[model samples]
Target: MSFSPDRSQASEAAPVTGSAPGSASGAFAIATQGLSKRFGNRTAVDGLTIGIPAGTIAGFVGPNGAGKTTTIRLLLGLVRPNAGSATILGHPLTASPSYLPRVGALIEAPAFYPSLSGRTNLEVLARLGGYPTSRVSELLEVVELSDRARDRVGTYSLGMKQRLGVAMALLPDPDLLILDEPANGLDPLGIIGIRDLLRRVREQGKTILLSSHLLGELEQVTDWLIMLHQGKALTCGSTRDLLAQRGELVVEAGDAMQLDLVARIVSEADYVVTREDRTLHIACPATFAETLNRQAREAGATNLTIRVKEASLEQLFLALVKGDRS
Candidate 1:
């Protein structure tokens, strides 16, 4: 249950310094400054700076081709940065070649032998990585794969494979875990399962960097967020702080005609509205709810119900991205 390693070892002598510019010393599990990466004439990540504080589940989200993967690679030292630098577990990425052992990563779909049992696959990885064999069982239990430990990976579901991949990553008992698209192809139940798994990992005091396109689900599991648009950070802050920035009032009238009247009144008030059936969703302040109700009643909107709706992460992300492009 303990991930803290003895820092007295020579390989661990110089932990990542807290002296990086713009990063709060000793507050982050991962920190990057002006990080940039390029492929020939194309730029993938551009001046991306982020600070993920220690022991929190931080989400990395963006549209396709937004350089999320490249940024992850840069943090893992899988590729050299064209400009800028990063620190993982307090060790400068390029300087602390030995720091990788303290980190666990599943960058993409992990390859496993379909013919081998799940446990055997993990054993192979552990042996190759010089990880202790005792960890194989421990990780299997942690990922809830102990029941299927002896089953052939070929027979496992996509969710199972993803869970197995997580188990492999935990084989080293790393303090920092970086997962790219961990819930990429899961059903609703599978997504929730992974969410719960991540919660458990956080409870164990491990810092997790989860990258996924499923913003709604990602919102459920993360406390902090880093949203990328076109390889640049659109926003970075706590999940609640970002979502609470926007509020909406939802009004449902009795019928379509009532909705139309209500919409006209709200539009007259100079607020944007989106209609779904008999409900009008307005992105406005909560204080406007009373005014909307009064306007709806004055306009003869019967059976009207008004309530506040918090902006969802998807809504906020889309709005930010679109606003940036504009």
Candidate 2:
């Protein structure tokens, strides 16, 4: 895996991974150039080039077996890319695993000794990882586990355990945090807790790459998106670009003769209409959906159903994957 951070020299970063001097607009906190991974006859993640800007959240989304996990592993240097390279903060990812200190990752489900207290467990990991003891309290509070610090980790609920994993990742005060399904299997409160914690981390100018199968949850947190389908990057860009849809109104009436009359009134005013399923699929501002619904009644059109077909992330994903297959 070839990973370079946005920074100049990665070693300059404190205990963990170093920060890139120039901002993400300059080099991008996470850069992957043609990154790919393969397993014999099967290709898990193919030729992926993506960039995650610092201080923002980038959602890596896909369904089961979409290779989102493989990509995350490659970025963390746990698995080497077969074809391309990636860098974190300008430092080559495969060059040194120690550079990971600058990064905190919640990969897979993390576990601790069943008998260890949450606080002691963190203290042990923190000391072993070379992070200051001060980080333990800070992270426990961040994950909302401070109140249960003295309890045995095994006694904690699944939600608490997951939160503790997140706390461990945050121990080094990493600049780039990678979380894969951080909200999995949590209650509404736990999900909201993770969401709020990520927001706080982002506010501190930390960059986060959050991966999840829950599109709705990600839609709530990310400013950008890198959608993966069948191990390839299907679409990547600002969320606004993906969500924006454009078109016009086409009204359909059971009586074609009557509909033609209405079309002519607007056609003379420089408008065109097309008919679909005996209903007109028009090109018009979505704001006018209600207006058209009301206008069709006065215009002598009956049984008018205003169905707005706007493109959404889910829709776009389907189109891209289907397009690829075809």
State each model's CA lDDT, in order: 0.81, 0.72
What are the per-residue Cα lDDT tens digits for candidate 2 across 230-326?
A: 8888766555445432224445555776566556545554444676656665543334455455555677665544554444567556756786311
Could you give candidate 1's per-residue lDDT for residues 248-303 as a string of tens digits?
77777667888888888889988889988777888764456666777677767757
Compute the lDDT of residue 286 as modeled in candidate 2. 39
**How many angstroms is residue 36 displaced in model 1 relative to the true structure, after the best TM-score fit?**
0.6
Kindly report which residue stretches of model 2 are placed more than 4 angstroms away from their true locations once superposed.
1-27, 245-311, 324-326
Tell me the TM-score of model 1. 0.77
lDDT of 1: 0.81
Candidate 1 ranges with C-alpha deviation above 4 Å: 1-23, 249-307, 324-326
RMSD of 1: 10.8
RMSD of each: 10.8, 11.1
